[model samples]
Target: MDLTYVVAMGSERSLVVRPPKLNSLVELLTSHGYSVVGPILRDGVVVLDFIEKFDEALIGVESAPRPGEYRLEEHKGAVFGGPVGPMSMKRWINPPNRIAWSARPEGDQVHVDTPKPRGPRAYLGIRPCDVAARTIFGEVWPGHPDDLVIVAECTSVGETCFCSSMGTGPAAGEGADIVLTEFGEGSVLVRSRSDRGAVLLARMNGAAATEDEIESARSRVAAAAESMVRSIDSEAAREALASMPDSAVWDSVAQRCLACANCTMVCPTCFCTSINDTADLDGVVQRTIRWDSCFTPGFSEIHGGVHRDSVAARYRHWASHKLSTWWDQFGTAGCVGCGRCITWCPVGIDITEEANRIIKEVAHA
Candidate 1:
């Protein structure tokens, strides 16, 4: 590697190294027995999936996201220009559909076996808010500690991004094994936060980064932070929602909501699921679990009928659970402020705007 790519290394963790040689990193991680998963453009939208090479990744593509509208735009050399897409990291870790267990009937006895996970997976280009969301998910679906988290500092913020108010960031703050900051033109600032990360950087043989190079990277992050346009006071929203369960905001939000469940599927931390079994000719059955959304009427179904009969009731349950009761269940709010729910919602409902309105109403009350 060139001397310009080199930077300082420290036992205390932060080190600067090569800029955006993402393909090489993919190769290295794959060789080290990790299933390399990263961002890629498919059908004019970015989705997180298993990527074999860096070229397959969305290196120069950007996304224009507004409430209920998303368009893919090409940016020739601007990697990391698009903030996030509809698919969150949840798709890979806690898949939408997976066989929970299988059972076969032989005479009067049944044989059953639960599916096991494959090798460790490495996630590239993850943002800080997504990292926080994953931490919230870990409380439910625990993964290995050694699973590498390669976080990228945002070079540009999305219009719907509210990570700033969530304190999760345009810049990744902890929970990452390795962090990357893009300084444009294929130059990136790399930092190894863990011993495993340090070992990986040492193998690259990149030169030390100078003081000026580090400062330049910081400036880029600051600019991205200032560019954020959406924000929500999560704490105040939680309090308001908790205090006003019978608030009229539900009817208002429901009028705009389609009960499509797109928001829950796109949310990185939403983890509701349902289980069912299927049988074939030989009396073989496979029980599977599929992702379930609260917006669906059957999700709250009981013996007589669905508990949440109206769309307004279902919407209320979803939002109230997300901001209010989620704290009592998960010890933290279930939202990471990725804003996927806003951009992908067919009706252009903005969660942050709704949250602020709820807070306003509660204050007036």
Candidate 2:
């Protein structure tokens, strides 16, 4: 396996390689001291989970199809194991629980305890939509917190994603240190997109890609993007939803809504978080941040007691944020249209179906 380095203009340095097997890939990373994690088929859903070693997992090499309603069987034909199954990036970025600090109170002096992060970690399998969601979140986390300091891993996108339509991805090739795309043959196309990535690729000896192989990697991405099923017209959607703020579209859907945070949780772009301080009887506070959703009743509490007192309004906020205000706030729509929300909503609240209705109503209005 030879490595081909591709450093596109205005982009990070990346590499493309064709690995003989999964272990070789892991061996290349672990030998360089990077901890690897990827998709694991556990608890029934193929999810992004920790892979102790290369032979430990290849779940990410398995992709889901049509919708997440059913996963495409794992084979030479399918890989790029979709995104994390509704778990917040928090699971990877922020350690499950960390003791922020510990202090000892002496007669008049207080001494605090400090702890450093474990080390760098790499997520083996990632989806393009989730990568796009991460790009949006990266901008939101200003002055990057020390907790979000894990070394980059990677994802394999699916045919069901519409990240490219949102100016996001089907190719999350830029931000990662190492990315693996399963090709038709039993070979995995590995590419490095950064200096951190270069160092990682250089370790693969034979598998480090060559300049010519980079073109082949590009072809695979171009072809896969063409195969994706779901899509949204970002330009039209932004224009249509921008003016129809108070349209009946949101309310109509609320009648059948379960008010569950399914959409937000399943949404890779969603970064709403809630924190709580657990206090001991002695008045010590243990602060922790948890993922939050706009559909949850408490998300909009304000001075008037509550601004969005109705389910319809909250639902509107969620929809409008995805289709409109998120662009105003974050410079892009909050959704990459992975359709996970529709599949996992329990009640089957199709965002695309709802958006179409709203667009139609605005046309009539």
Q: What is the C-alpha RMSD of each candidate to the true structure, in Å?
A: 2.6, 4.7
lDDT of 2 at 112: 58
Across 1-365, the per-residue lDDT of candidate 2 in tens digits comes to: 22222322113333333443566656666666666666666655666656665432343245453443545455443433443354545456644344566555556776655667566666565665555566676775422232111221223444445656666566663455555554434345555555666565666544234445456656777775676566677877777888887887778887988788877776766677877667666445565667787887788887777778777887878888898888899777888766677767777777777777777777788
Give the C-alpha lDDT of model 1. 0.79
* TM-scores for every predicted model: 0.92, 0.80
Q: Model 1: how far is 244 from its true place, Å?
A: 1.5
> What total of clashing residue pairs does each candidate reach?
7, 19
Give the local distance difference test score of model 2: 0.59
Evaluate all candidate structures by whole-model CA lDDT and list the values in order. Answer: 0.79, 0.59
Estimate, for each residue in 12-31, the C-alpha lDDT of model 1 and write its tens digit. 43444454366778888998
Q: Ten residues in a row with the worst lDDT in model 2? A: 145-154
Model 1 TM-score, 2 decimals:
0.92
